[model samples]
Target: MTTPAKPTKNFRFVTGNDPDFFKDKKIVSANRSFVMFQQAKKPCDGIDPLKPQPQRVEKASKRCDASRPQPRTASIPAGAVTETPCPPGMSSDDALGLFRGDRRARKRLVDRPQPNQRVLNQILSLKAEDLPFATPNATDMCSFYALLQTEAAQGVLASRGKLTDGQLLFEAAYEGFMSTFPLRVVGSPHDTFEVLPKFKGDFKSSMEELKCHCSATFSCPNLGRTWIPKATSSKLSFLSTLCISAAHLDAMRGERSIWAPLMGQMIPLLRIMTADRTLNTSDQAIISVLQVLLGTMIACQEVSSNIHWQGLAQLVTLRGGLLQLDPVIAMMISIHSVESSILSESPIVPEYLEFLRQRRERSQPGQPIRYSPLYSNQVELMELRHDPYCSHNTYELLCDIYSLTNLISIMRSPIAELKNFQSLDDMEAERQSICARIACLPSAFSGDSKDLSRRARIVRYRFESCRIAALIYSNAILNGCSFSYAASQITPAFASSVKKDPAPRQNGRNTRSDSLPSIYRNRPVTITSYLKQLLARSDTSGLWGPLSGVLLFVALIGGTAARENLPVPTSATDLGTDSYNVKDRSWMAAVAVRCGVQLGFEYQGTMEKTLVALADVTRMSERCDSAVVEGWRASQEPEILEKSLHDGNGSLGNTSAPQTRFTEATTNEIHIERVSEGWPSTTGQADPSSIDWGFLNGI
Candidate 1:
């Protein structure tokens, strides 16, 4: 028998039944089977199993007979094997298909007539070699930007009702801008305000140049004014829109790295762009930009600290600030600045007043009332917008309260320097003016002829609370103690001085009694009255929201009253205090805490600190009261008197002229429930002897 097999040089196949048949028979059988298997694997006329595979087979090389390694075959071509130029006038869909990896689609795209024939040809002709420095010229880039703007706007509008995959559109637009206007802003992946580096060309000139590159013919006539180069406005408007949209997505999904930096970069640019001389500051375009900036700042909690808030201050100071700014935004900036100033203890009272003045100057006779972003964004909250007639009055009321707070800050500084006497006369005059102004404003709490809104009620409560707080400040200032000075005076030496009378000086004047402010001097009734009003307003519901904003101010007033050695108000008319007769100002301090809790804000990270601080102040106030009472008692007790008589009680005998003892109290635990329900019970006896006067200023 013969095996019809090709033989390798390493071995040979032998026919059957020859000499050496045993060894050769085994080898010959194996060789014949292997040869048949190899033939089976190869393409055949019709019988090969693997022959129909599309992958080209490699020819095995003769190296060392069956043991040589095989090399990998290419799956697809890495580069164009042949040039296939797209015909001019191809449709964009077919042209875009090339990017989608449909090689046949490139040919199909050439079947249509393209309007941008030249641009289409240039794009199709691009090779790996031409990409390094390749760029579209000015006109082409501008056209391209227009195309991108349309696409981005369509995407934005499509997703307006809900945020869904919305970030992709903005992200693409932002990426395009960054690539096209490379020098406009420079920063790492994360920066709050990215702008051109200082080493670059003049920032203004560079920005103008960048804006000019994208300048097109489109205009938003509705935005008012044609001064802003159409392209410049469009580019900025698109960026701002993209940024805010992305921020909305981020706000919902919390993709922190995505939107935070986008806003951080965009807000500063918007500020700089609005400040650009090329754009009319009062143009509707710039106004829209500012509104978005302010709105984003208001909406995003993370943005609160990163933005250049002072830029808003500068804008408000400009002639265009008020003219261009919406009254709602201006009011927000004013309120926010004042709140921040009070917190930092570095007052920006002048800026706030300036914003208020601008808002008034721009106020029109019959314009619709404006609402804050929170109200505007929520349908439920929209009802909080006050009537047009009452809107101006509402803000005016707020302005008066802010002015009083400014005065209080000014008084504190002078009092701190002990030069308060120089300003006292001026402050007192201003105080009376402010009071008369506050009184002239329609009551926030009462009698509505045309309208009464929840916001109006909130405003009324705010006005009343601020009015009472201002009174407390003035009361402290009049009695030879500014709030700061009074806060600093909670010491052992000061506590000891509480019981002493003014000795007759050689000048024939009483040292202690003469310098006291008349409002707080020789009368516990006035201090008690102010404390009662402050506590009443503190517990009032309408003011519950802004209470947190003005917490420190309220705490200061409460602190002053609590440490004044005056009894808590016994008036049954005070909101929740009808059941308890208070003896110290601790209840007043507790009022701030309870109001914060009732508003469901006590658990906030920010308010938690305020609560701790309030508690500390309350505890300190109680300790101080105990010290004053104990010191007074030691002076009044008969046993001590007999001992002092025997010991010739030096100054203690001279000061025991009068003492009014209410029930004693000690450091009582503050109760939010009792505080919310009513004033805390005054059942426990207090000992003033344990008071630590040294740390009062520390609190």
Candidate 2:
């Protein structure tokens, strides 16, 4: 037996006991064994035995080891709109027509063999890297590499879960945060604004020297200028890459509104890019900040911001101040600042309107900022400047009005910029600067209401009404002044006073002995009553006719101020914000409803978004539980989550928008539902606990 075993050992085995042998190899040397039934420790919905069960748990590093996000697809590059129009029977791809001239060719067309549009696109889209600006410097390369690292890390994140409910995240037990998209936007070798702007200056110039910086992000084109935002090309800078990606994701969020996952990935990258103190004021850095801000506005179609506007504003200030900023962008920032002030009902740092005033002075050296006497508060309304091609006057006036409301807001609420104040004087200086801003308003239309056209008069009345409301609100905040006092304060006597004297006061001192004007000497009237009477005397006769834009601003300020000091409704039954009774109809609610509806905004999200916009633009804000607050007459049933299987019943009638009917109500007691445009009114009170904060201004 020992001799036979020794002989066997001398011969090598053909297969596995030598590795693949008894290891369940296929056929005679099969490696794996087949089981009749695949079993889990417990029952599950999973169709695959290898896959983790839905109920309890699964190992992620094993089962959920999804591939990293894919590399970005080649984006369709866009060039200047000057290309030859697409030929007949062809699509936009043929927009640049083929060389259909004589086959003999005068000088031989480019791409002679096959008229390729991409050749033209390549030439047009190529960034001249040889140029000084395009050439990579140390900082740009560093930023590019850091961004690259961030992208690589972001790609490693597993995205293998479903978010069944409305709320934003998906859960993979092993990984903290998971996304649904298999692939996300990643930086590519070639990426930039799909639709390039016709550069007005040196196209190769760096951002700081570049003359044409459209407010639109490099990820997209100017809103209505093109049907949709085009894909990014290779022209964009690394500093703005994160912002553009974030914005592009926002823009392409067609049917799905899941921004949480996208924002989660991008925000960290943005923070990383902006974290370094050295890059805070860098040109590309500022561009990144502004792109995020502008991108947010473009996506939501709302001027109000829920992002880092303070950091953005700081970057703008550090760079060169908003005055040196692009005109369109500067104005938008100024408006946003003013609205934000109103929303938070507090002061923003370094008042944005100061930049506007400086811009005005730079544009017109001799003409000083002039104040409108129609405003009880000082505001720089444009009266002297006129341009047939542009409506700078209206815009300037609106800006001033926003600034004034902002001032009033500051007086009422806690200032957010206080932490940034270098000294206590900075606060007082802010107040003084606000006063100066008001004094700078153009007053050409303030003095002579009689000289104004009917159209002009209507406009003046509407806006001036806002001025009065702001004054009243400020007065209330300061001295708890009554509506009558508010009415008396709005005296348009400055022009008359100047005309009567024909002499500049010795030291430009106000010499008036009586605070109350002559007309109000013996009369007792409220602002709301006075405004109604004045409107009655006007050509339009009421707050009716063409309405949109700044009218919402007026409604919030004027309506809130005009509302007689009724005790704010504490109970669900008490709803009227204004009296709609005949003979004493304040019409404040009516004006609010009319202005809100005239906005033509869809019923959904109107309340939240508009409320937010009004607060920003006008500084007038009111509290309402938008989520629970039903429309004119909506009803809802609580969703029964426990019961997943239903007998398949149709949903209840659409109580999404409420209904209303005219009825005689003798008392001031009325439904808040009556004048709601965005918020539908319900018969019962809304739950105060549920509120949507999307549109709320800072306050």
Compared with the true structure, the alpha-carbon lDDT of candidate 1 equals 0.36
Model 2: per-residue Cα lDDT over 20-122, one tens digit each:
3333212221110111112333347855345323222212222322464434432111121113232234332222222222133245365223223332232
Write the residue-wise lDDT of candidate 1 on 560-589 in tens digits: 443333222233112123112132233343
Score residue 154 of candidate 1 by CA lDDT.
47
Backbone clashes in candidate 1 total 11
Q: After superposition, how far is residue 38 of candidate 2 from its true place, in Å?
A: 82
Q: All candidates' TM-scores?
A: 0.28, 0.28
Total clashing pairs for each candidate: 11, 33
Cα displacement (angstroms), candidate 2, residue 613, comes to 17
Candidate 2 — worst ten consecutive residues by lDDT sum? 690-699
Q: How much lDDT does each candidate structure score?
A: 0.36, 0.33
